[model samples]
Target: MRERDIEIYLRDEVKKIKGRAYKFESPGNAGVPDRLVILPGGRVYFVELKAPGKKSRPLQIAQQKKIASLGCEVLEIDSLQGVDEFIAKVCEGK
Candidate 1:
């Protein structure tokens, strides 16, 4: 599916699990993830959505590393399966 479709599915699934997925944007800091998902019990994560077969750019990878350094998880989702996998991961240990 398309990137937007993946994002929409992800957001909807997050809500079903009683979480919130916000569109994330950093004006000066480029390569930020697309959505910030917040779950119960203080669970938080970042997700970068891309079209199927697409990969993260170098700068996006760099930014992901930076975000990881801050102790936050960053994931890249390129397909519907990826979104399902992410939901499963985040929903674990809840």
Candidate 2:
């Protein structure tokens, strides 16, 4: 599927679970993740959506690494299954 399809699915799924998936943008800080997902119980994740079989660019990887270094989770979702897995993960321990 296309990246936009995956992103739309993700947003819909997250909303079904009472979560918020906001379009993330960092002005002058290029290559940040595409979405900021916030779930119940204070769970937050930075998500990068891509087309199937696609990979993040080097700058995106660097930005993700930087986000991770600050003790936040960064998820790269390139397929429908990846979005499912992410939703399951967010629902865990609830």
Candidate 3:
């Protein structure tokens, strides 16, 4: 139940739905979300992956809030079930 394991699962599942889960990194931008998920029909999301029962750090929360202020979707996926729920919600009606 490490963070990387959850990340790999999300990437694999997103691929199954023909989406891309990119490792998102911004140099000099500490606390940015970990993944940039782009689904079909131009749906995009910024995803922060954490270990099971782990919460985001304060700076991460700030970054996520800034992204949300831009009217974009931000997700915090800490488990495989979270990934599945994300796909089911966003990929609905596609």
- Residues 31-94, candidate 2, lDDT per residue (tens digit)? 9999999988998999999999999999999999999999999989999999999889778857
lDDT, candidate 3, equals 0.95
Tell me which residue pairs clash in candidate 1.
none
Candidate achieving the largest TM-score: 2
Ranking by TM-score: 2, 3, 1
lDDT of 3 at 19: 92
Q: Can you write out model 1's per-residue Cα lDDT over 1-94, one digit (the tens) per residue?
A: 6899989999999999999999999999999999999999999999999999999999999999999999999999898888888888877877
Question: Runs in model 2 with CA error above 4 Å?
Answer: none
Q: List model 3 lDDT by residue over 1-94, tens digit each.
A: 8999999999999999999999999999999999999989998999999999999999999999999999999999999999999989987858
Off by over 4 Å in 3: none
Residue 12, candidate 1: C-alpha displacement in angstroms: 0.4
lDDT of the candidates, in the order given: 0.93, 0.95, 0.95
> Candidates 1 and 3: which is better by lDDT?
3
Better of 1 and 2 by TM-score: 2
